[model samples]
Target: MAHANDAELYAQWLELLGWLDAEASARGLSFEKVADFPDYIYRMERPYDLPTTVMSVGVNSAGQPLMIAGVSPRHAQLKGVSLRLMGGSKHWHLHAGTRGLLEGKRPFTRERLAQLLDGAVRGQA
Candidate 1:
C-alpha cells in the first residue's frame, strides 16, 4: 500500500512539474528547483512586485509527498497561499479576489496558479 501511494504521488508530482514548467515559460516567469531539497521556486522574470513563491514537497508518514505552496516575504515567515497540491489533486482554499482563508475546496488549475503567482509577487496573497 505504501509503495502504491508513493508511486501515485510521484506521478502526480511529475504532472504538476510539467504543468509548472510550461506555465512559467508561457507566462515569461522563472521556475527553479531548489538545490538541497525537493522544493521549487517560481518567480517573476525581472523586476516585479510579487514575492517569490516556494513549492515545498514534504514526505508524509506514509512516504507520500505533499506539496504546499506559499510565499516567504522578506523578513516574514512562510504564509499559505490559495492553492495546494495534495493527494494527486490541486485545491483552492481562498476566496476569489480576496486573500481570506475559507472552508471547502475548489479545483486547482494552471490559470488559477498564475493568479496566485501574481498575487504572491504583489504581496497580496
Candidate 2:
C-alpha cells in the first residue's frame, strides 16, 4: 500500500484534531491547543478537580503520522502508545498500537475519542 504524503497526513491530522475538539465540547470539557509545529498538542480538562488529559500528533520513526493521548504530565512518556494513520483508500481509519489488541482499529469518531479521553483521565492508557 502507498503511504500518505505529507500533505495528506497533515489534512488527516487536522481532521482528527477537529473531531477531538468537537467531542470535548459536547462533553462540556475544556479543550485547548497547547503546542504546534513539530507536534500539535491539545489539553482537555473537566471542571472541578478532575484529571486533565493531553493529546498530541507526532511523526513516528517511520515518518508516519500518529496521535498520542494520556493523562497530563506523564501522558507523552507513560503511554507512548499512538494511533497511526492507515494509508490507502481508507484514509480515515487509525491503526491503534498496543491498545489496538483490545479495542481494535477504528475511525476517529466521537465515541472513540471519548473512550481515549476517559482512559487518559483515569491514567490507564
Candidate 3:
C-alpha cells in the first residue's frame, strides 16, 4: 500500500456503505431505483426525509481519489490505478456496488471494507 491513506480511505468507504445498507434493510427501507447516472448507487431517504441521499463508494486511484465502480472508458484518467468515487469524477463501479448494497444492507464502513478486501484476496467474503 504505497498510498496507505488513500487505500485505507477507499476500504473504509466500502465498509460504511455496507453498514448503511444493512441498517436500511432492518428498517424495511428499500431503494430499488438507481440514480439518473449510470454509476453504482441508489438514492435513499426515510419516509419523511427532506431529501434523498446520494451515496457513492469505491476503490481510490493513485494520485487521483476517484473510485471506479463498474466500468468506464475514462478509467485511464486514473492511469490504471484502483480508486473509488471520492473526487469529482463519478466512478460508476462504486455507485453500482453501493446502489446494490443500499437495496440489500446499509452504507459501507471501514471495518466492512477490510473484510471485503480480505475476501476478495482469498476469493471469498
For TM-score, the strongest prediction is: 2
Q: Candidate 2: where are CA atoms >4 Å away? A: 38-106, 122-125
User: How well is each residue in 8-124 modelled by candidate 1, as lDDT tens digits?
Assistant: 333334444566666555645555543222232333354433222333322121333233443223333323333454454545543221222223344345666567555544445
Name the runs in model 1 displaced over 4 angstroms. Answer: 1-4, 36-105
Candidate 3: TM-score?
A: 0.27
Residue pairs of candidate 2 with colliding backbone atoms: none
In the range 1-125, model 2's lDDT, one tens digit per residue, is: 23333334334445556666675555455555444332223333523221222335432223332223321123232222244332322112343332221133443455766675554444443
lDDT of each: 0.39, 0.39, 0.33
Misplaced by over 4 Å in model 3 are 1-4, 31-125
Candidate number with the higher TM-score (1 or 2): 2
Q: Single out the weakest 10-residue window by summed lDDT for candidate 1.
A: 1-10
- State TM-scores per candidate: 0.39, 0.41, 0.27
Q: Model 2 compared with the native: what TM-score?
A: 0.41
